[model samples]
Target chain A: MSTSSDEPAMGAKKVEGAGEPIPPGKPMTMEQHIVDKGAMMLQRLKPMKQISQHGCSFAIYSHDMTRQIETHHYCTRINQDFLQCAVYDSDGSHGRLIGVEYIVSDKTFEALPPDEQKLWHSHAYEIKSGLWVNPRVPEVVVKPELENLAKSYGKFWCTWQLDRGDRLPIGTPALMVSPQGVNMGVPSPELVRTRDLKYNILTEAIRDSRVEIAEPEWLNPMADYWKQHGKGFKIDVEPVDMKLRAPFP
Target chain B: MSQHPEVPGDPTATTTSLLEKATASIQRFGPISHIHQHLCAFHFYSHDMTRQVEAHHFCGHLNEEVRQCLIYNSPEPDARLIGIEYIVTETLFDMLPDEEKPMWHSHDYEVKGGYLFMPGIPGPVERQDMEKVAKTYGKTIHFWQVDRGDNLPLGIPQIMFALTREGQLYDELAQDVERRYKVSFAAEKEKRKDIEGPEMGRHPLANGAGKGLQTVLKEVDVKPPSGTTPRVFV
Candidate 1:
């Protein structure tokens, strides 16, 4: 039987210990290992089998465009119009799942309520700038995929802010925005240089090849919540009296 | 009249269609290729039992014991992206810290009660999958509140829970799912009778049983990136 290296091994260790260890404790306990092994043998993880695409990019905090982090996306295309990605801090075997991103076609995005549209950001700039790339796949195999993504929009949420030096996922989830352009002062020169160097590809060369991927004219104005509105949401935990809205029952 | 008031249709519709087709023919679309299962179920807000919404789970396995799912409000091509759920075995769930356990919900009830089903798959095949799912646990957070008639996902993400026993799920909701999918919950429940649940009862704290849990978002101050002067956006 051929085993795919990308597949998480049975009894895989829980992804932890990135950044400074808050409260700094010892490594995984013995009991944790045993339980993981037992679960590996007993459970059938049927949902992870479909991660078909891998892309690397940078994400800026929606509330603070100055704050940025490199993101490794393991995505599963739900259909021609939608794709969901599990965002990690790295592409290594031990990368932690820091957030999730949902990508939809312009057709799907445009249909959203105007207020709702602000939560999403367009991908055209990221694709055309060569800031978003699938490192493992050949350019020929990935271009068409980029072509489709060029006109798409994505809503990203990061549970763990490793860039902010958070020891673990704490506080409320933060919304993330895509890099718009170099002139925007996001996705710094160092970020692009490191990614290109690590992956052995030239961002400028890739950018030149993607000249045909035009920006969609009908792009929603409210999209890119932070940039367009000059303000963004900052999520936090608060106590509340919960009530049920209609149509739920 | 347009079905969506926000979208008046675009003039580039024809060129966009051609570009999509051309890309579809050659794109590898590697990331989404492993999605092989679509399980339909209902999720209620953890804070309120009376509020519930249909969840269409498109899942893929990452390993023998861990699975991740992307939940949609509907099964249609234009369905709204609502939430995400991560599933793990009882063994793994047992390893979680006491405070963390409450965030995860058990699948025993969702499976045995027949509230979960794979649309269009053969009963036997789906039953086998459900049997495996019965002993698992899931943690879900819904970003979009479609039930509230929100066109776009708004507000804070809320943690969600699964129905654990009889009388928790509304009858009308079950009927609506039954009518659309052409599957009887009663028949599915009967068929799943022989399926064994977790050897041990589900974690007591899971699903916020007998307790109210909700997420309320507050506005917080944003700190600049470490060791750098904050750049002000004009």
Candidate 2:
């Protein structure tokens, strides 16, 4: 019964032509009336709390380890085992919906068949290395949240390969993987610097903040696996001294 | 015991060798490193259809314009690979052929109604993101009707998505997702108060009334491959 005052009444029309003669009044069609009512009703409806409202940022890489992208993830917890994330290119309102990610607990990951399991990537490295972060949250709260996220596994598919210069999402969706071990893939130095400057925190410094959060036993299998089969390379894992860097220009 | 060349005679040497082999075996299973994001959401065969299925989507962002998600039956490890969903912007949707246009469903209704949701996202951020998502469109087809208890993906792939409007969605289906996920649609609806609903008339291609699968099927004049009746959950 309630309605917003701003809404235009159904079938209301304004004459536009200054020189042309006005036409005789025409009755609104049944379909037009119905559509207008539906629109009006929907306008007054409130949003649902089915998904979580919080947004977090992640520095993600391509499946082939070719490019690094900074994405904003707005996630909703479905249950104990699953969390669905809506991915975007930025935290701003104009950010594009680039992809979606699903995070599952270790128990759910284990239940997957071998081939299916291979399609999913682990969050252990991201968590342990502190590459994944909730930069918006206060420092005090972020540690515990990061520790909690450390224990889960995530699978990401990026539909828009912006790096390839495709205006629209075309072709197959590429499977994205997290950086592994000390040898996390090549993230653009400029992009990382820009993100770090915006958040005013470094990945290494964030990683160091959680040095005391013990690694769960579930991570052992994957750690051992990476030791054996992971690409043998090393990237800088040093924590940046925040005091030493110049203030943002 | 000392005869084998690989096995050293010294007690310390033997212990070290055994430790090395144990480490090697443990490392053989290796680390999983391809998938980047995980999402769990509900998908129905058609906007007008009532049957809703939960999907665990493993996705990768190819660029700013496209996201490809591999849909699964469940979040469990044994979850079957049921289908793939390709999400695109309005710019992309407009580029598609008329035939291809009907295959994709607009997110306007689903987002405004709060039916299409990403479960782990917080309410405020999700609302903001939904505004953007509402403008986009998705084309999905499920090869497996796993929710119907079919052991294998039976029959031809059926186009599936979320209901566009309130009455089109069955109460039972909405309740089922709510009960399983410990979420309330009523609460979600309340949280989405500020997001403006899509203007239906402006986007004829995205309109739910004429673009639903039923209407599309009628327009195309094709029956879903002979033996299979489109599964409709009460």
Candidate with top TM-score is 1
Q: Give the proportion of true interface contacts each model preserves, from 0 to 1.
A: 0.10, 0.00
**Of the candidates shown, which would achieve the greatest lDDT relative to the real structure?**
1
The C-alpha stretches of model 1 lying farther than 4 A from their native spots are A1-56, A62-128, A133-154, A159-172, A180-185, A188-200, A207-234, A237-249, B1-12, B194-196
Candidate 1 residue-wise lDDT, A96-179, digit = tens: 556788788898887777766877888988998888988756677667678888999998887655565443333346778888
Question: Cα miss at A133, model 1 (Å)?
Answer: 4.5
Q: Candidate 2's residue-wise lDDT over B96-120, tens digit each? A: 5443455566776666566666555
Model 2 misplaced regions, further than 4 Å: A1-50, A53-63, A182-186, A220-249, B1-138, B141-234
Model 2: per-residue lDDT, tens digit, A160-236? 45544434433333445555553334355576677788768787776787778768676524321222243211111
- What is the DockQ score of candidate 2, to 2 decimals? 0.03
Q: How big is the positional error of residue B227 in model 2, measured in Å on the Cα after superposition? A: 50
lDDT of 1 at B197: 76
> TM-score for all predictions?
0.68, 0.46
Worst 10 residues of 2 chain B by lDDT: B1-10
